[model samples]
Target: MERMKEDQDQIYYHSGADLESVKDSPFLEKLIKKGYEVLYLTQAIDENMITQLLDYEGTKFMSISKDNFKFGEKDQKEEKEKNKALKKMYKPLTKFLKKKLGDKVSKVRLSNRLSDTVCVLASDQYGYSARMEIIMRAQAFADPDSFGYMTPKSKIMELNAHHPITKEMLRLVESGEDDERAAELGHLVYDTALVASGYVMRDSDYKSYADRMYKWIGESVGVDPSAPIVEEYPEEEKADSEEEKSDGDANLKEASSSSADPASEDHSEDSSEDHDELLYRSRTRVEDEVFMATVSVF
Candidate 1:
């Protein structure tokens, strides 16, 4: 509060894991670049604590990551007019993103808060902050039933219409020739914004993000994403397999030849008879030993 300018009536704050993280957040790029003072709330309890203290000394506390955040009142009209023009210009792109992102985002719109960043995810005014959601999720892990009622509202994706990637996406969306590519790009941007805004992505969302990333990487390297990966066996491995097969065939032939020989069959029958005779003598000797031992004990 002491750091606020004389005319500043709003105390802007951002919640994050640490000071460096909140300071380097994409959500604060435009605000920071414009010389706006933002309080970096890094403690686990800061978000929850700030909610209770809504206002300090008549200066309202506002999170820059919320959808209802606004800049100074002096240029409010001008900013709205500019945003209106941009919304109209990028209507198709917004529509495409909304359709592609589905329920992940509450809405897709052009952002006035972004300057250097391509996009960012913003929470609802009264909804949970990204940090709060993280805390709630951690709590839910311990007592799932108690926190089952806690469901975070979908985030609002704010895209920088001035960014080159956004412009290219707009073009891809307008052209309709690369609808699939455009959809992939839209999903990629949304997933990136989710992480940038410090929200945990669902399993399916992460899977889609990984698939898109791999596809783009493959495309960049001139590889066909749809092509099947074929594993090639080495010449040495093939030679070894053939040698084993040949050895098995030779062993099988030798066994068959030995089984077919009359002399070998006679020898096998003689060996069986001799084995039975040896077993009979061994049992008789054991019985004799047991009788002698019993007599001595008596």
Candidate 2:
């Protein structure tokens, strides 16, 4: 919370920058640019405590994460107009994302606060911060069903107009509505932004995104995306005949009999065989998990 005079009614806050090494984020950068002195609430308790307190003296505390945060700068009007223009310019792509990513995001709009990043996720005025949701989900007693309702809904995605990635995406959106690649890329962008904002994603959705990423990687590597994987099987070793096995057993018996202290002999080879059995079991288990993941994605 910002230090205030006795008559002051407004307070500004900055959270999640406890460590001195924590550099300026898009949110903090925008605040700094506006010449506001923000009080950083680096500790987890700092935010929850402030939320409980609500106000100090006559001033109401405000969080940077909240959409209602506004710096009363004289040039704010011009900035608002610029942001509105950006939203209008990117309306097609925004609508495309909203439709394609239905329910995953509440809204898509032009970002007014970004400096360097291509896009970022912002919660509504009453919604939970990504950090707060993380804390809630981490609770041991949290019920999946009840927690779903308690969790924040509809994070607003803010896109930067200056970034090359956003620019290219806008171009793709303008190219045509029939562009399947654009739609795929749009989903990728949303997923990336969602994760980057510290929100959890459904396992199935994440797996699908990973599969799409692999396909993209294959294409980049000059491999055909639709091509079937070619597998090379190693040749099977020939099994020993019954007569050879008998001879080998006879030789082993003779050798054991020759040894005065057969029990004292090293059994490392037997132990190695046991280890190999365990290794094979472990490998099979891992392969089974991989298969399950692949199936879930599909």
Candidate 3:
């Protein structure tokens, strides 16, 4: 964070350029001693390591990224409230689209991820985010655009009340009942979201969707999806990283005194997926508890 520290307005001190050069600043030392709050933004910041470094510093280390980027919990509440209204509007249309797509896609459904707009083509758990795809394409590292083009992943059609075009659409649907225009509009909304979510639009020509959106914008103040964000951090996110270091030293002593087993060393190595990640690990910990309990007179 040495170079990045100067760019950050709030950062007080810059540690030297490299990891080996990193040492606690005298200023940070005083702050931690006084029980003050410090937010670490380093990309190299590891929680496990911090848990092991508490001995001399007597400080706590908490991750700010987990607090900031934690979206799963918030999405759950929004999902419940919006999904029903969305399903009512788009469910039939989604089924129709599924038939049109045929063997091209898995299945079609109404999106619970929609807030004020309609549709989003989301990937499953391990799929790449939009920005990540751009990097991969720039480098030509992965099958750059092969899986992107060929994947039969489908878009979920999500209809919303607050949407300007959608408000007009609901009125049209009510008036026409079984109109061809309403179905066309439904297709347009779904296609728009697909493009927005970094997927190729289903329609090569979106002249009608463009005209509809333009007409709506011309009549009103225009659509702005950027909502006012009120930031709140969870208290559960706070943990004492330094406590591990003091515990590590004491545990290491005990482990060394115990009868050495070559098998135990091999087992420890096999358990940890990362060697560098184990650098901050406190000695034996969960294993010690299990060993102590198991070896008791039975």
Best by TM-score: 1
lDDT of 1 by residue, 1-298 (tens): 7766555568999999998898889999877766778988999999889999999878889999888898877545666888887899999999988887778878999998899999999988877788887888786347645554444546799999899999999999888999998998988888888888898888666776887899999999999888998999999999999999999999999999998899989998999999999999999999999999999999
Instruction: Rank the models by TM-score, top first.
Output: 1, 2, 3
Off by over 4 Å in 1: 5-7, 140-153, 234-298
User: Mind giving the per-residue lDDT tens digits that candidate 3 earns over 1-298?
Assistant: 2332222222222222243322332213323432334444233333334435633243223221111111123443555666667667755555665665444335566433234444445443234333234334555457745657523344333434445776665666567675565665665666565565554443644675676666546546755424455786665443344566778988998898654677877777777757655754645576777789998945
User: What overall lDDT, based on C-alpha atoms, would model 2 receive against the true structure?
Assistant: 0.72
lDDT of every predicted structure (CA atoms): 0.86, 0.72, 0.46
For all predicted structures, in order, the TM-scores are 0.76, 0.68, 0.35
Q: After superposition, how far is residue 12 of candidate 2 from its true place, in Å?
A: 4.1
TM-score of 3: 0.35
Candidate 3: C-alpha RMSD to true structure equals: 34.9
CA error at residue 62 for candidate 3, angstroms: 18
Give the C-alpha miss distance for residue 272 in model 1, angstroms. 25
- In terms of lDDT, which candidate is strongest? 1
lDDT of 2 at 34: 56
